[model samples]
Target: MKKLGFGCMRLPLKVKKINSSIDMTKTEEMVDYFINEGFTYFDTAYMYHDGRSERAVREALVHRHERQTFILADKMPVGMLVTKGDTSRIFRHQLKKCGVEYFDYYLLHALNAKYLERAEKLGVFEYLAKKKSEGRIKKLGFSFHDSAKVLDRILTRHPEMEFVQLQINYLDWEDEKVQSRLCYEVARKHGKDIIVMEPVKGGKLADVPEKVKELFALEHPDWSPASWAVRFCASLQGVICVLSGMSDMAQLKDNTGYMKDFEPLTQKETDILKTAAAIIKNEETVPCTSCRYCTASCPMNIAIPEYFTAYNKRLAGEDYKLYLEERAKDKGKASECIGCRKCEEVCPQHIEVVRLLKKCGEIL
Candidate 1:
């Protein structure tokens, strides 16, 4: 385990579906490359890739490799839980889907203030503890997406949680809205091992603003922008692994190449990133992670994530019209949002999807 985990959320799409159609051939290649390079941690969720990601993990990694060689992690879909019974049912279902008898890591998916309340009411944590006790879950944890106060409360109540998955990146490290620093400090204070997600801020920091890019260049000329962001999270003290949702061969190679022999950032390099974060903080960009959670239940079938990506690129002064056109080919334009905020409800980043879609379509 080289502190780099393969996130199966954004597996290469085989074709354009409202959700996604995973290209298994390329996914297998990515998984094999990752394992061959000595990385084993793989993270998937119940709703990732429209609930098909776990099966894809089976096909791409689990079926091909020996179980002992890789560590598989899955989460209970907290948003979709209708009853305490559903937790047990979905856990069993996930085991069958991933073709495994037990999960190396099991989590309460997207544990936030709202979900935490619901999960407690439904006895979700207690059920997971039973699973861990039964050997179905090796380690119990939750992926958090709320404030530090909420985190402290949960950890205090549920000290049984073995680890925590947090969204950590240089850009959001000190952002008031994200509260990455605060949440991270809370996790550290609890004495928990941390698995980092969104280290590159959903690819936004990978293609940063010119000034920010230049700052990174001056610090490490050969390092890619993504390398700096990923390494920033990996360099942190308690981060057990930094998960990158690599979508293609290029991203896979780039991430694994840099992480093969990991190094921590020196004080001066950390200072440069601090300067880079200051410049990025000034940019007015949509804070979407392209999670596609918004489009999961969109009545109009809008390509919400794609629209936001193009809009962000435009804010960066790049050509985005063609990309927008391609993204809107068979899907609803952003103008068709109809003011329904179903997207906002499930979005981990709390983006104003309807309003941002209106602006993105206006640009088109």
Candidate 2:
């Protein structure tokens, strides 16, 4: 896999949907530019953009480009599967959606303590092994969203996994809940290669506060903040690639520019990032990681993850008020949490979801 993989999660949207109406003219141009620049890895999941991501990748890259030219990676949506048979159905559907004969990488999507247990009890890992043996999937691993301790357990138990995908970035390097660095270390200790996702924290690092942007601009005014993020993930040893969810032509162009050159961060740049991380750490409200385990058990159909994401932005104070206002428009407001502890039950981070929702309601 290349050092920079294009994440298909936050692809261009139209009418608040995945925008199956992909800007193919520009997207095709971006794909040509990306491959010409020597970056060839693309990551998507079944649930991303409500299943439109797979088809979009087909239209944007797979159909237009040769199979061997790029590595296509997708994850099994284990959370949505109600029975063991659903795995084959979704995997088969993915093959059709992406217009691919085999996946370069396949993952057990978004594993945590609960989901891992579910997958194990239901024989998902074994099923993936069979698919690999049959040559439908090339490499098998998992995308994780839990604590370091849970990660340690998973790696210890599943040494057959080729690599692990993690949500790693400067912001969550030492986060108590996310523990990006801790999970990376755990994987490395197990001798597993890492696929880094969210190196830019869902594009939060792209356009940051003026002060944060100014700090980075002092180093290289020509480089976008996105470059620094890609460099940060690239700087980490044992990483196979850093996934960037590019949504527009400008972002794709800028990212491919830096990724083509593929330079890791310098010692000075690392120090600057560390300082910037500190600045961001002190500003976050609730310290939520947006893992969405809370949503699994919500009885009132509350969108706990969305609320927490919005609440964190509210905690960032004045600079992120726009984010707070936008997310607050959702039907599942913090005030609608219903005080159910169901969300807390599945949270590996043990976040006080109900109480925090209450606090967010007060603040926002």
Candidate 3:
């Protein structure tokens, strides 16, 4: 597998929505360049691109190349499953959608505390394992978004897992909210091969604050913002590949250039990034990972992640009043909590929902 895997979640969107429309020509060029560079890992899921990602993969990568030349990773859509029989149906649909007979890599998509429980109850792994034995799937694994403790518990019981995908980047390496270090440590402790996602923190680190950019430019003026992020994940001991959701061809070229013959960040470079991450963490007011678990149980139909995002920006301490003014543009702010405790219960991190909302409301 190539050190850089193309994430299909952020493929060119027409109207900022995944299913609005796709730019086929641009995607084709990017895929051609990606494969021409000797890279062969592509990842997609059901919910990506507003449920059109699988079909786009068929149009972009799967149909264009021989199955033997590249590896295609597809994920089970547990959120779409309503019963045990639905698993086979969804799997078959995915096969038809991607126009592939078998997947090189198959995962239980977006495993968190809630989704993991749903998967276990629905016998997802059993179905995937059975398919693997039947030669329809090559390797079975999962992409995780959960706490270190939850991840540890899952790995302990399912050591048969061939590999695990995690969100690993410099920003979340030491974050209490994302707990990237602890989660990766747990995966390594269990001897699981790690597939890294969000190496650029969903593109937030790609275009960093000017101060942080200036600092990195002093040492490696030629390195792009994305290079610093990819190197951070690649520097880790057990990372197999880092996934970058490149939306344009320029990003594709920039990333592959640095990742071609991968260079691990030196101790000095790593130290610099750590200092930069620290500065950003201090500046960020709301610390949300956008996992969507809290919104799963929100009673008042509030978008918890978006609210927290605004709240964090307000607390950034620079032009906070301006941040508050911007947040007012949203129809639903944090003040609409209505004292609902549903979100708190579903939060695996046990964030003080009411308290945080109160603080956020004060800002609003």
Candidate 4:
């Protein structure tokens, strides 16, 4: 199988609204082009694109293509569980929504240390394993977001999980909070196959600092910034696939073109990435992956990611004042945050929502 997977989280949206529908026509074209390019892995979660990613994949990929040609991966939103029966209810709904009887790869989504404990108490692992046994799911695993110590515990406790999905990229590789490298080592230690998510760090690495750009130009001027980020993950041992949330045809084309015959980065290239990480780390603030987990239940309906993107732009010395103004229309401004902390609870990045929103309010 190819090392690249299509992540459905950042699929193009039809509108700027929080609960806006997906742009289906463009998505279908992306799906066709991806399959035609000899790439088959497509991953979606229950809450991706406001609960529409699965159905969109159903219309764009699953419904239109031969099921045997592609690999479909969907995740159980373990963070959304309120009762033990949630595992059963959501699983049945996901099967129906994706227009599939069985999933090629299924995982419990966003397993932080706290959620991992909750999943155990609620019997989520047992439920998903039974589905796998019953042929409703071909493989079962989890996407993790916590530290290495917590990860070691979960992997030790649930040895039945076939693979582990991790948020990995050159930028976050050695991040003290994210611990991408440490987590990768832990997964390898447990002998679990790895599915990499956020290889481009939610579009952060794709748009790099000028210093990093000069360094890349010195090495591989032909390569796009995204190519370097994605390749970094694919080159890692035990990484079965690197998932990129390509939002448009250009992105899809660029990703598929480079990954068609993937090459692992050499020692010198790896050293360049290490230096780039140090430069990016100093400039980064709020480290939001634009996962939009924080915006899902925002009482003020703030476009949190958009504001953060604008803030990052301003810090990067890019023009963002007008852009921020436009995004603030029909959406909650940074000043509207009530400090309820609801968004923080669901946030996988461990960002201080109230605090950051306050900062965004001041500048953006």
Candidate 5:
């Protein structure tokens, strides 16, 4: 397998708000293409697409191909566990949902300081160790979203974790809030291989500012901006797999085309990326990563990520009127935000979502 893993979070959807409305035909085609190209790793979670992501994997890949031909990874939703049995219940449910007898890689999903405490209290690590000993899970790890200090503490306490999945991209490598480099160093200190998520910063780096695009074009006119972002993450030491949440065929093709013959970015290209990151930071756009975790529990049926994407486009001087109109036609607009701040609580980036929505109401 190449160093690229297929991320099953943002699969093509037929409807806007419904997670169960996955476009299975397109997804199956994409999966066939990916596997035919010799990439086998796939990563999904319990909460992704409201539990339909695992089911989609069953339909698209597991049922069609021999299980031995692909490597499957799934996560236990540690953040949502309120009782000791919750972990076991969710794990069993995930196995049935994905139609798998054993997982190639199993993770404790979305661990931060608070979630880490809860996991310890709930004996989540002990449970994972038991599962691994039983041969149900080949490898155990965790996906993290926290500061470097917290990461160090977690790794020191749980040295058994095999790998650490992190949000590593050119834009967030040195970001004060993300501290991608700091977190990565902490993981390496514990001798863990890295699985990179959000290598494009939720597609923001793919649709970069014109100035940054010009810089990239001048240097490597043949490469797409997304290729640069993915290559930057793959170039890092100890990175084993870079996950791309491909939503369509074009993205899958572009990603595999470059990653098939992977090459580390040159020193000149790395410096250019640093300059581009600085330019992006100065834009001061809302730093929403579009994980869509906020929209799952929303009461008003607001499409928070879509609104943020449109608002960011407007900030980048792109005409967003038509986009805003279309979004409003299908889902609640930003003006409909009720100041409940539910979205802000779930946002991994710690984005002030309510304030940003208010600003989006004004501008978009």
Candidate 6:
């Protein structure tokens, strides 16, 4: 398989809203293009697209292709587990949802500090190991969001984890809050192969500021900004795959074009990316990836990512009234957050959601 994996989290949507229905026809086209180009890995989760992504995979890929031709990855939402038997119930449901008898890669999704405790109490690791022994799961791993210390502790306790998925990109590589480098080092220290998520920071790096765009254009005018971002992660030694949640054909083509003949970055390119990262750090923009992970669990049903997008555009000098017009459609504003903190717990970026929502109250 190639280093590029097709991420199904942000499949093309029929509507533009967060809970909009997927455009399965377009998704099937994108899946065909990806596999024909020799990329074989497809990643989906139980909560992605409001539990529609797994079914999208079944419709677009599994029904159309040979089972042995591709590798499919699904996740168990450990954070959403409320009962002792939820693990097995969800695992069986996922297989039925994805229309697969087994998963090539199965993960304990979004393993943070709180979720880790729940997983241990529920005997999640033991359950996954038993499934792996039964040949229902070929590879067992977890997608992580906490600090390096937590990661080290987990690895020490569960040496059975075959791979660790971390959010690694040039922008967040040295970020104190994200701790991408530290987590990468921890995974490598434990001799775990890495699978990278959010390589383009959920499209933030792909559409950077004019200054950063010009920097890339000056040297590699032919390459898309997303290419540079994905390659930066793929260039790393222990990284087995970099997943891009491609939403359209252009993105799929752009990714496969560069990844077909993969190349490690030169020292000069590395320095250029570091400089771009510095400029991005100085910008007064929200770090939200627009993944909508926060919105799924919000008690007040606030459209957190949409508000953040509006807030970011406001920071970029867009009119405030325009943001208000968009916010009207959402029907839930930032001021309605109520400090529940459920959104914060599931966020992969580890953003201070409550504080940011208060700021959004002031700005949007």
Q: Estimate the TM-score of every prediction.
A: 0.80, 0.79, 0.80, 0.80, 0.81, 0.81
**What's model 4's TM-score?**
0.80
Superposition error at 157 for model 2 (Å): 1.0
| Clashes per model (N, Cα, C within 3 A) | 0, 0, 2, 0, 0, 0
Cα lDDT tens digits, model 6, 242-333, are 99999999999999999988999999999999999988778667789989898889889887887778877765434555566766575677
Q: Write the per-residue lDDT of candidate 2 for residues 1-364, one digit (tens) a residue.
A: 4588888877776545435655556666777778887889999989877678898889889998989999999999889978989988888999999999999999999999999999998899999999999999999999999999999999889999999999998888888889999999999999998999988886667755566788898988897877887789888999988898887878888887777767788899999988887776665466567787777677766766666776665444224556655654555667777775888888888888888778666755
Candidate 3 residue-wise lDDT at 252: 94
Cα lDDT listed for each candidate: 0.89, 0.83, 0.84, 0.90, 0.90, 0.90
Predicted candidate 5 versus true structure: per-residue lDDT over 1-364, tens digit per residue: 6899999999999997577799999999999999999899999999899779999999999999999999999999987899999989888898899999989999999899999999999999999899999988999999999999999999999999999999899888887888999999999888999999999877777877778889899999998999999999999989999999999999999999998889998899999999988887786677888799999877887878888888888655466767767766778778888989888788899998888788777755
In lDDT terms, how accurate is model 4? 0.90
Q: Report the candidate with higher TM-score, 1 versus 3.
A: 1
Of 3 and 6, which scores higher on TM-score? 6
Better of 1 and 3 by lDDT: 1
lDDT of 4 by residue, 79-187 (tens): 8998999889999999999999999999989998889988999999888888888999898899999999999999999999989999999887877888999999999
lDDT of 1 by residue, 63-179 (tens): 999999999999999999998789889988999999999999989998999999999999998888888889999999999898889999999999999899998898888877678
Off by over 4 Å in 1: 284-364
Model 3 alpha-carbon drift over 4 Å, by segment:
16-18, 284-311, 314-364
Candidate 3 global lDDT:
0.84
